[model samples]
Each structure stands twice: as C-alpha cells, then as structure tokens.
Target chain A: MTADILLQAVIGGLLMGLIYALVAAGLSLIFGLMDVVNFAHGELLMVAMFATFSLWQLTGLDPLMVLPLVVVLMFALGVAIYHGLIARALTVQFNRGMVQIFVTFGLGIFIRGLAQFFYGGEFRSITGGMVANRTVQMAGIYVPLPQFAASLVCLGAFALLLVISRTEFGRALEATREDRDAVALIGINRDHIFAIGWGLGAATVGIAGVMLATFYYVSPNVGANFATIAYVTVALGGFGSLGGALVAGLLIGEIEALTALVLEPSLKQVGMFVVYLAVVLFRPRGLFGRL
Target chain B: MEAIPDNAITRRRRNELRCALAVLVVLAILPLPISDVYTQNLIILTLFYAGLSQAWNILGGTCGQISLGHAFYFGVGAYTSTMLFTHLGIPPTLGMFAGGAMGGLMALLIGWPCFRLSGHYYVIATFVVGEIGSLLFLNWDWIGGASGLYIPFHGESWINLQFRTAKLPWHYLFLTFAAATWLVAWLIDGSRWGFAWRAVRDDVVAARSLGVSVFRSKMAAAVISGFFTGLGGALYGQFVGYIDPDSMMTGSLSVLISLPAVLGGVGTLWGPVVGAAILIPVRELSSTFLGGSGRGVDLMLYGAMIVLVALARPQGLVSLLALVRGGRNARTA
Candidate 1:
C-alpha cells in the first residue's frame, strides 16, 4: 500500500530534482568561472517569473511561449548588473574580497525591493498556462503535465550547456577561470567571456521561473526560498562545479522528498540543510570538486 | 615601545570622556521629554538594533567572518528565555543570562564547523546552518511550534520587565545594552584577543604565522558576539512581550542586524551605534509615511544603502565622521 506513495514520492522528487539542478547550474557555473557568488541569482529567477507572469497577463502568452523573451531579458539584466555594480566594486582596490560579497547581497535586497515597489507586496499566480492541470498515467502512476515540461526544459538547458562548452566562448570562460591573467595575455577578452557567463547563468533562471509559474506562487520574497536552496545546492555540490550541482540538486531533492515521505512534510527542509552542513563540515570541496 | 606623553594622553582621554558624557546625557534625557509611546518604542527599537549590530560586529567586523545566521542566536535568546520562564516559572530577569549562555553555546556549536570555511563558502554555510536552526525550531512542537511562545505580561513590575504606561524603563534597558556592547567592543579594540581577532581578520595566513590561533580567535569572537546578542534578544523579547521563530530567527532579521555594521563601518567600535542612529530613523520614517502600500520601500532603501556603501564607501559612515574630524583637527595637531 505504501509502495504507491513511495513510488510517487520518488518519481516526484526525481522530476523536481532535475529542475533544482537546472536552477543551481547557473550559480555553479558563475562561481566556477568568477568565484563571484551571485547572491542576487534567486532575484533574477523572481524577475523572470514576474516577466513570464506579466507576459501572460498582458499579451496572453503562456509561460512556455514567453520563455525565450524572459531568458533573453534576464540575460541582458544579468550582464548589466555585473558591469554596473560588480565591476565597479572589484575596482575598489584594498578590500575587494569583502566588498564583492556585500555588493551582490545589497543588489539582492535592492532588486527585491524594486519588485515589491512596482508589483506591490501581493502574491501573484498565473491563471492559465500551456501545461496547466494536465497529467499522464503510467503504470498506475500519474505525472503532472507542467512538471514533465519542466524536466524537458531542464534537459534542454543541460544540452544547451554542453553545446555551449564546445564553443569558443566556453573555452575562453574556462581559460579565464583557470587564470585570468593568462587569458588576458591570450587576446581573448576576459570582460566579454565573464560577462557572458554571468548573463548565461542568470538566463538559466528564466527556464526555472517559467516552470515555477506553472506550479508555484510568485512573490518578491519567493526568490529568497529558491536563492537559499540554490546556495545550498552549490555548496553541497561543491562550489563552482556544474555537474556536481546537478547531482547534488537531485540528491537534495531525493532526500527532501524521502524525508517528507517518512516524516512530517513541514520538516522536509531539515534533510537538505543537515546534508549541506555535513558537506560544509567534512568535505567542503564536495565529491567532484576539482583538485 | 613608543610611549605617549602624559599631557597628550590626558588631553585625549578628557576629550573621549566629554564625548561619552555628551552621548550619555542625550540618551538619558531623550525619553524623558518624549512620553509618546510611538517615539519611545522607536528609540528602544533603534537602540536594540544598535546593540544587535554591535554584537554582529564582533565576529563580522573584528574577525571578518560574515555570518548571515545571527538571527538563529537571536531566536535562541528569545526561545531559551521564553522556555525557562514558561516552563519553570523563572523570571525573565534571571532567564536573560541563561539565554545568553545558550546563545554562546549555540554559537560555538555552529561556528566550530563553520570557521573552516572562508569568504563565500563560509557565508553559504552559515546561511544554511541558520536556516537549519530556524527550521528545527519551527517544527519542534515542544517550544510552541509555529504559533511561537508568548511571554505573559503582568502589571508594571521591574522583575517582569513589563510596564503599563511609561516606556522609559525599556528605553533605559535597551540603551544600557547598546552602551555596554559599544564599551565591550571598545575594550576589545585594545585587548590581546582583539589584536588576534584583527590579525586573523586582516590576514589569516599572516596571523597564523604570527602565532595566532585563527580558529580559537574566531570561536571566541562568535561566542561572545552570540552571547551578547542573545542577551539583547531576551531584552527585545521581554520588551515586545512576545516571541516567534519566524520573526526572531529569519534571514530578514539577520540582514537587519548586519546592515547597521555594514553601513557604519565593519571594523570600528561605534560603527553599529552610528549606523543604527542614521539608518533606523530613516527606516522608521519610511515605514510610517510610505509603508502602508509601499511595503518593501524601507528594505529597498536598506539594499540601496548597502550597495551604496559597498560600491562607494566601504569604510562606512563612521569613517566619514573621522575624516571630517581629522581634516578639521589636522591643523591643530
């Protein structure tokens, strides 16, 4: 009897884990390249969700249809945030390290405030979307339609990342991560590569946001939830490792889902936080962290 | 070692004594003239923040370990005292110290594993741990769970720390803590432990080579910081007469506590007080005037201020004061 509940939880967690992986991948990539933890990353996802929600309200386009627009817009915004704020902070000379951390955090607050200011503090949810209220039955189990679409999008993001890595830009980004000074010597522009990485990292939130619009509620503070989860994922997965984020994201999802299955649903977050603490305490570099 | 001239040292000490006295006079008298509950509460809240931020400043400013989870300690302060008072019928006056001890112990437990990380990793770890603590508190039904524990208010009594009319008692209590926090920080600025903390903060590798135990110093800073902050929390909970996990132990509270130190100056003794002095009034005013529909405006301003400080003047507003004073006084010296 409990087998059905267990199977459902496992399948549900697996589906969710992939999306978590997608959300965290950008943060991992950004840390991987720049060592700059994008503290405002979850805000970017929040912005993307709002963009998709607004598109639905105004133009009558579903989140799936508005995904491209949100992605492109978020990418541009991410680029601007970096060059405008982060770049300025880096040039401060003496206390660059502390300044770098707080700049993103400050930006995070500012963005959340902007969202609240413009949209008001009310929680908004999309009324109808491409993948709403539909599910598929497989072997006496049902799969939510939007979540299925979300998993597909997650896969697409990974494939796209794979494709991107083979490109010159990815190589430049990798080089920059390896040695910023050496890359500067090689005639490949460090600024462009880093900015693009930042932009792409932000753009991935678009994929996450559009999916979340189908299933979750949207508010200014919603970003804080995803932001913390993403940070935990990045930390658990090993800072700066995309593949690790993917695996760790799934593992966290599984733990969370399994904990909910066995224990109270309210305490589900305990599982991942404990795991994250263990990771930070014992193997901070994480399982697949680079030597 | 270079020795200071007797006259010069006395002159500086006299000037410092005068400044402290002037501040003391102002704080002592501010609530006297203002009988309005709103203004009194604002002063108490602002001072509360000042103390909390200074507590944060110990680890954050002195050791350069930015913890986004001090709220966990704050919540612990509130919860620990509330539990002791509610379960054992012990007065909050005595419960305050016990709560502080709990906070210190919690800080040690949290910081022991956390100090291993530095920079971004450390921040993330602290953040996770804070959330973990908060989640555990929220789920545990033994401590009143999500509804939060409420401290019963009695007729105006010193032991109960409750008042029927005047807010002066609470204001004085808060002022005392803030002043104590400032004084402790001032003392630590000259102590060997303080030197060790600053040494480790400035350069851990160099500090280690200089025979400083980076771990021990950070642990001490965190413990003391949490202990004092927990005391402030007990005062805050008693002053407010209610306690909740979400309200006390959340990221927003963490950010609120740290913002003052960030805006004022991370490493300075009086930065938290000065930062709170400047920002809290603005926050209070914004929330009062534009707060109804324009919610998040205060937060937006805070965010902007943080970004402004980080990008423009990482030295903090206290440095600006110092710059002005030094600029003017340079001619005399």
Candidate 2:
C-alpha cells in the first residue's frame, strides 16, 4: 500500500477508534457499577441518533447542537429501564447473566423495531452544508471535518468522565463497583447510584451515536453491528475499566481502518476480531485491565 | 393383589411398551399429514433446531458453559462438506462425518486453553473462536471470500441427498437426526460420564477433590457438542443448497441453537424439543413479515422471552412441565 493511503487509513482508524472509545466507555461505566452488560447500550445510541435525525428534520437543529437533549433523554430512559426491570430481577433466583443480556437485547430490538416502524428503513443522515462535505488535506491524506469533530467530541467526553469518576460522586461509583454490598454498608444508596451510573453510561453513548450518524448512515441494524464491535472493544479493554475501554476502542478503530486500506473494507472487521482474539489469548485482562 | 404379582409386572411392561409405540406413531404421522409448505418447512426447521440445540445443550446447557459461538463448529462443518463435495466429488454423506471430525478436533484445540478459566472466560474464548472462524471464512479467497459459495443443484442423488422433490426427504432426514440426538442426549444424561459432567459443572474444585478429571470431562463435552453441531451445519448446507459466511457464522444462528435450549431447560433431555416447539414457529412468523424491515422486532421479542424466562423461571418450561409430571407420578406411586 502507498504511504499516503496507509497514513490516511491510520488517521481514519484513529478517529473511528476515538468514537468507539466514547461508546465503549459508557458500556464500561454501566458494566462496572451494576455488573449488567447492557446489550441494548448500542440501541440507546441508535435512539439518540434517531432523536437527532428527527430534530434535524423538523426544527433544522444541527446534530451537534442537539447533543444535550439527546443525552438527557437517553439518561432518563436508561434510569427508567434499570429501575423498572433490571433492579427487581437481580434479587430473584435466576441466571442473571443470560437474563440481563436478553432483557437489554430485547429492549434493543424493540427500539430498533420502533425506529423502523416510524422512520422506515431508509438510510438517514443529518448533513449540514459545506462542513458535512468538507475534508482537510494533510500530506496527501484527506480527513473529513465531521470525523474530526467526532474525534474531538470523543476525547472531550472521555476527559469529562475522567473528572466525574474522580469526584465524590465518582468515588461512590468506584465504591459501588468494588463491592455493591460494602457500598451499601457505608450508607450509600447503591441502587440510586447504580441507576445514575447506568444513565450516564447510556447518555454518553447517546452523544457518540449522534456523532456516528453524522459520519455514517443511520439504520435499525446499525446498532446491532456497532454493539458487537462495542462488545469486542469492552472485552479487549477489560470489562469494567474505563481507561482500558478507551484505549482498546481506539486500537480496534485503528486496526480496522488500517486493514481496510490494504484489504477489502468488509475484511476490516475480520482484522478487528483477530486483534481482539490475540489480546484475549496473550493478555486476557486487556491493556489496562485490573488483574 | 399379592397373588397376581406376575400379571402386575406384565401389565406394567405392556404399558411402557404402549407409550413407546404411541410416540413412534406420532413422529411417523407428523410429516405425512402436513401438506402446507409453510407448516412443513416450519416443522423441518424446528426439527433441525431441536437436533442442533440438543447438541449444544451438552456443553452450554448441561455443563453451564454458555457459548455464543457454537457456530464455529457449525460453519466449519458446512464449509468442509460443501468444499469436499464440490471440489473432490466426495459424497456429502461421507463428507459430513469428516466435517464432524474436523469440528471435534478444533474444539479440542481451543478447549484445552479455555476450560482452565472459571466463569465467563470460557464464554469469551468460545466467542473468539467463532469470530476467528467467521473472519477466516470471510477473508480467505479460497472459500469465495465475502461473496459466499453455492452448492450445485441436483435433480436426484442418493449420495448427495439432493432432490428436486418436495421437502419430504429432507424433513424425514432431519427428523431422524433429531430423534437420534434425543436418544444420544438421554444416554449421556443417564451414563456415568454424565454424572461426572454434572459434578464438574456444579463445582469444579469439589469434583477435582473427588478425583474427577474435570479437564478431560469438559474436553469430552466440547468434542461431543462440536460433533453434532457440525452435523447440523452439514444438514443446513445441503438443505438450503447454499452456504454463506454470514448465515453460517452469525450470532443469530448461534442463538437459534442456544436460546431454545436455554428457554427449554439446559441439561435436560426434552429441553431442545420444547425450545424448538416454542421458538421456531415464532421465529418463522417474525421473519416472514417483520424480518426484512431491518427493524429489531424479531430480536426484541426473542430477547424479551429469554430475559423473562431466565429471571422468572431459570429451569425453563421443560423443567416446569417435568415438575408437574413428577408430582403426578409421586401421587400415583
């Protein structure tokens, strides 16, 4: 492959990886605190994307401008779902792992179905004039403006989450993660904290989703595809480590993008999984995963 | 009553024989009476899933190792047999056995390193194996890459099991396979090895303390599980006459085998049968109308069922049914 093409792919992959980190960081947050792997996390992002799509359609609001509304709505939805179904089920005698997986998976499907029913299956994009189409040329490599914006947003969110986790509330979240029972003995309302964590996680992905929609097409099945990638990223980063998730997400994006330059675009996913499996074999705890 | 002991024993034996006869009769009559193409297709699909799920149950349901990547074996089996038949002119019937051998061997390769980890690690390893298979199949130009491969059509061939007739032959073949799977599952459940498996699943450390070869037991489970799943792949390829990477290796297909068993009752004889009965029809109906919309309708419904069942009744409907039957038996006794 030509140096320019390879360099472009690496940059593209790195940008995609940042977005993956954003999505996966939310997954890490929810999974870390509640021990619930939300299969519908991607669907939450899909919903956010659709929300932005609708707002852009009706009020002509830009996707970036609609981020706050998307985050709030998704956060509320996540909290509601956690309280309504998940919390109660965790107390019961059952296969919590598979059951939660299915529950979230079901929610994902339902959301996707609703999206299809309301919006149809046509690919939807929230494009706004020259910025949407504009690309910067650096050393013979083209970088789309939207992608660059998404990367910036991703990094910004990561920093904000880092700050939140270090605060008192964030410490409670850490305590919640270390031991749910111990967290309760210390007078913390674990359930409420968990709900908040889940909400934040969902809301974070909501921002990622809108950014994704800006760069690519929005469809019902898009969430499922991205969810699998998110799962791969989570596993690669170590399940509950946010920093690990970010690093793993970026790594996957870079690998996929770089591979796509030399190999068929579809085979890029193959490359992503190859790296994931290799990580699992050699370093099961992930790059920054706790032993 | 004391004077008629011989007669009582004979009567009990006769009753057992009658129940067996009735089951045979039902299985025989199912395909013949159903003429509707959709209904027949659904039944055949159910039987195919029943067999596949039963095979999956050995590892996932029985051993409590939830593997979402059983399709690795399934894909390997499909590609191996299809390739053999098309390229080397080997009969698919023979190729199927060879395919199963390959799958079983591959399981041994992966299972050795994976089974050492306690919980969820095995699940992750299995998922990786499946992804690897999918990747290799998708990228390797030898297997047509992402474009996929198609088996040549046949008018009538005993060797190929290809026919231009109705779905009757395929239906019978799959049904026979399902019954064989049930029989094998029952045998394993009752065998000494089955007890060892239960011990390992319940507590590996305890089983090891008791001198059970936990590693060997799990490997055996994986091998057997992979063998039958491979058989499923062979059957799937021949029936559809086309094998693509996505259809063969996707998580959705893996769900077809595992979800039913999970819903029915893992580690139980009738789990696959029950799961197939409930899920196959629903899946068919959903795919018929709602599948093409690219919406998550089918998946949502399927996931809801799994979650509800897992939370409300982890033992599944089969176990519940067994409990009812068991109560009646106790009362009679």
Candidate 3:
C-alpha cells in the first residue's frame, strides 16, 4: 500500500511538474534574453487561463480546442507588455535595473487588481473540461484523465519549443542574447528579438494556462499560487535552460508531494522553499544556467 | 579659496538640515487639526511606511542590493513582540528590541547565502526566504497558525505601548520612528559604512580591488536594514494590535514596502519619506474613490504609477525637487 501511494505521488508530481516547467520556460526565456524579469509573467498566465475559461464557458468548447485562440491572444499580451513596458525599462539610463524591477512589479499589481475587479475574486474552473473527471486505473494506481491529457499537451508544447529553439530564427534570438552589440554588427536588430522573446515567453504561459485550466481552478489570485513554484523551478533549473526547468519542476513537485506524505501535507510549500533557498545558496547559477 | 569651498559645503549641509527640520515640524503640527480617526490613521500609515521605506533604503538604496523580502524582517518584528505579549505578558517597548534582534537573525539567515547572487537574482533569493518564513509561521500553531495572533486590548499605558482611544499618540509614535529612521539613514549616508555600500554599488570589482570586504559590508547593511524594519514592524503590531502571516510578512506586503523606496528615491534620506507621503494619500484617495471595496483598481493605479515612474522618471520623486531647486539656484546665480 505504501509503495502504491508513493508511486501515485511520484506520478502526480511529474504531471504537475510538466506544467511548472512550461510555465518557467516563458519566464526564463524573457529574463535570459532581455534581462527584464517580468513580475507579471504569472499574471499573464492568469489572464490566459481566464481567457481559456471564458472561451469554454461561452463557446462550450474543449480546453484543448481553445489553445490556438488563447495562444494568439497571449502572444499579443507578451508583445504589448514588451512594447509598452519592457522596451522602455531596458532603454532607461539611470538605475535601469531598479526601474525594471518596479515596472514589472507594478505591472503585476495592476493586472492582479484588474483581474479581481473584473472577475470578482472568485475561483472558477472549466467544469466541462473534456477529461478531468475520468480516471484511468493502471496497476492499482488511479491517474485522473484531465491531468493525463494535460501532461500530453504539455509534452507537445515542450517539443514544439525544442523545434522552435533549433530553427534559424532561434539561433538569431540566441545570438542577440549572447552579444547584442555583436549581433547588431551582424545586422540583427536586438530590439525585435527582445520583443519576440517576450512574446514567446507570454505565449509559453498561455499554453500552460490551457493545460492548467483543464484540471486546476482559475482565479485572479491564482497567479500568485503558481508564481513561486515557477520561480523556484527556473532558479533551480539554472535560469536560462528550458530542459533544466523541466527537470527541476518535476523534482520540486515530487518533493512537495512526497514530503506531504512523509511529514505533513501543510508543510509542502515549506519543503520546496527550503530546497529553493539551499539551491540558490549553493548554486546561484542553477542546475543548467549559464554563470 | 579653500576656506570658501569649505564654508559653502557647510552652508549647504546647514540648508539641507534646515529644510528637513522644517518638514518635520510641519508634519508634527498638521496632525493637531485632523481630529478624525481615519485621517489620523492615514498619517500613522504614511509615517509607518516612511520608516519602513527608510529601513529598506539602508540595504536596497545604499548597498545596491534590492531585497524584495524585507517583509520577512517585518514579520519577525511583529511576531516577536506580539508573541511575547500573547504568551508571556511582556510589553512591546522591551519586546520591540527583541523583535529587532530576531529580525537581524532572520536577515543574517537570508543575507548570508543570498549575498552571492547579484542584482535581481538576489531579489529572487529574498522572495524565497520570505516564502519560507511565512510558510513556517503559517504551520506553527504556537504562533496562532494561519488565523494569526491577536494582541488583547489593554488599558492605555506608555510602557505597554497601548493606546485605545485616540489616534494622536499612535501618529506621533510612528512619526518619531519615521523621523529617527530618516536620521539613521542620513547618518549612514555620511558614514564609512554608507561609503562601503556605495563603493559596492558602483562597482563590486573596483570596491574589492580597493580592499573593501564587499560581502561583510553588504551583510552589515542588510542586518541594520532588517533591524530597523523589524522595529517598524513592532510599531505596526502595537498600533494595529493584530497580525497575520499574509498581512504582516507575505509577498504583497514586501511589494508595498519596497515600492516606497523605489518610487521615492533609494539612496536619498528624504526620497522614501516623500514617496510614502505621495503614495499614502494616493492609496487613501483611490480606495475612497473606488467606494470602499473597489477590487483591484487601487493596485492597478499603483502599478501604473510604478511603471510610469520607472520608465519616465527612474530618479524618483526627489529628482523633481532637485530639478526645481537647481532651477532656483540657476536663476539666483
């Protein structure tokens, strides 16, 4: 029985971890390239989830079906945020770093507050999601169908990201991050790359939102719930590496779930935070992050 | 010619002191006419934040290490005194110092490891530390768990730091803290420690080459900043008479604490106070305008303000004053 429980916990953790990895990828990409940590990344995720929820509620469509629509809308958000806030923050001369932090932090507050104002602070979910209620029984372990589907979608998204990152455009984007002046000398506009990076970052969260909406509740404050974990995942995975984020996310989820079973359920966050602090202290570069 | 420059420097210092004193004096008298509890409450909040921002400025402003998690120290202070009062019947005046020490310990725990990470990465480390703190507090039932601890209303006494009826005492108490914090920051701004911090801020490699222990200096600044922030938290606990992990030391509170220094001016003594002055009023007006329970609009406004300020005016509100003063000086010359 104990073995079965542990197995389930591990599986559950992996499932949740995939979404977390996907979530952190967006943040990592933006921070890696632009040097602007969008404190509003999670908020954008929340908005995308809300959009997914709204789409389902209105059109009575499946969560997966709404992915393309949500992705487009989220891309617009990412681009808009870049043009509107991130671009300006990057160019500002004095204390540009501090200014960038405030810009994003403020944007976070603004989005969260607006979400609450419009949505009324209540948690809502897609009750009619295609697969949430159904569970598959495999060798005495139950895997919820919605979670399974979400995991599959998350895998697909990660693979797509891999494909995108290896393309000629991806190389150019990377070149911009490596050396802006060097890239510009080679006739590449870093500004456009940064905007695209931000857009991709926001869109990554949008995809996470779609998968998440299938199984998790969405609310204005929901962004806060996921943000810390995403940050921990990104930091642990070593800042700029997508694969590292995926591995770290799974590890964290497993740790959280296993700790809950071994010690106490309430201390799940405590366990993760301890690990996060320790990792940051020991390896500031993170698992795969460039020093 | 050398004596003339010295005389001019002294005169400028004197003028600055005079301006600071004039502002404080005006603040002290202005509370007299405001008899309403709400207005007094606003003054108390403004001053409390003013103090909190100054405390943040010590590390964030001077040392160039942006701590997004000073709320951890604030929570430590609030919990220390309140816990002592709730469990052992100790008054907050004595407990406040204890709280400060506890906050220092907390800072040490966070700063020791986090000093390795520079810039926004360090900020992220602070956030994680704060998360751990609140989570621990949330689980520990002895501190009242998630429901949080409440300080019972005792009769009015200066020693206990308890005042039941009027907001005047609370206003002045916070005012003293705000003023004292400013004084501390001013002193630090002039002291060797402040120089060390600025040295680190400008260039860590250069500062290290100059034989300065960048780690030790940053750590010292963090400890002092944490201690003062804890003291401020102690005052906030006494005045509010209630505390919770979320309200006292969570992520939101951390953002609120950092905003003042960021918006006001980090290194400048007057910048934080001025930022608090502007924000507190804006906070009150927005909440009122939105009709008591307007969800998210106030936050949106604050967000808009931060973004606008950061993008257009990274120098903070104090820079505007400097510009005006420079213009005046130019015209006079």
lDDT of 3 by residue, A1-291 (tens): 478888999999888888888999898888888677778888988999999998998899888899999999898889898888788888877888888878887898899888888887888988886686789998889999888887888889889989998999999988988888799898898888888898899999999998888888999889887888888888888877888888888888888888888777777877777887788778887888886
On residues A7-39, what C-alpha lDDT tens digit does candidate 1 reach at each position? 999989888888888889988888888778888
- For candidate 1, the per-residue lDDT at A263 reads 73
The candidate that achieves the highest DockQ relative to the unseen native structure: 3
Residue B250, candidate 1: alpha-carbon lDDT: 92
lDDT of 2 by residue, A1-291 (tens): 677777777898899999998898898888778778887877888888888888878888778888888889988988998897788667756566666765666667667767777777888787773357779887677899899988998999999998998899999989888888988888999899988987899888988997887878887777877877888898889888998889899899988887777677766787888777777777776667665
Q: Which digits, one per residue and each the tens of the lDDT, describe model 1 over residues B126-216? A: 8888888888888888988888888887678888777767788888888888888877887787678988999999989999999999999
Off by over 4 Å in 2: A1-3, A137-142, B1-24, B116-118, B289-300, B329-333
Chain A TM per candidate, in order of listing: 0.97, 0.96, 0.97
Q: Is candidate 1 or candidate 2 better by TM-score?
A: 1
Model 1 alpha-carbon miss at residue B103, Å? 0.6
Ranking by lDDT: 3, 1, 2
lDDT for every model?
A: 0.85, 0.81, 0.86
Better of 2 and 3 by TM-score: 3
Q: DockQ of all candidates, in order?
A: 0.70, 0.40, 0.77
Query: Which 10 consecutive residues of model 1 chain B have the lowest summed lDDT?
Result: B9-18
* Per-candidate TM-score against the hidden true structure: 0.95, 0.91, 0.97
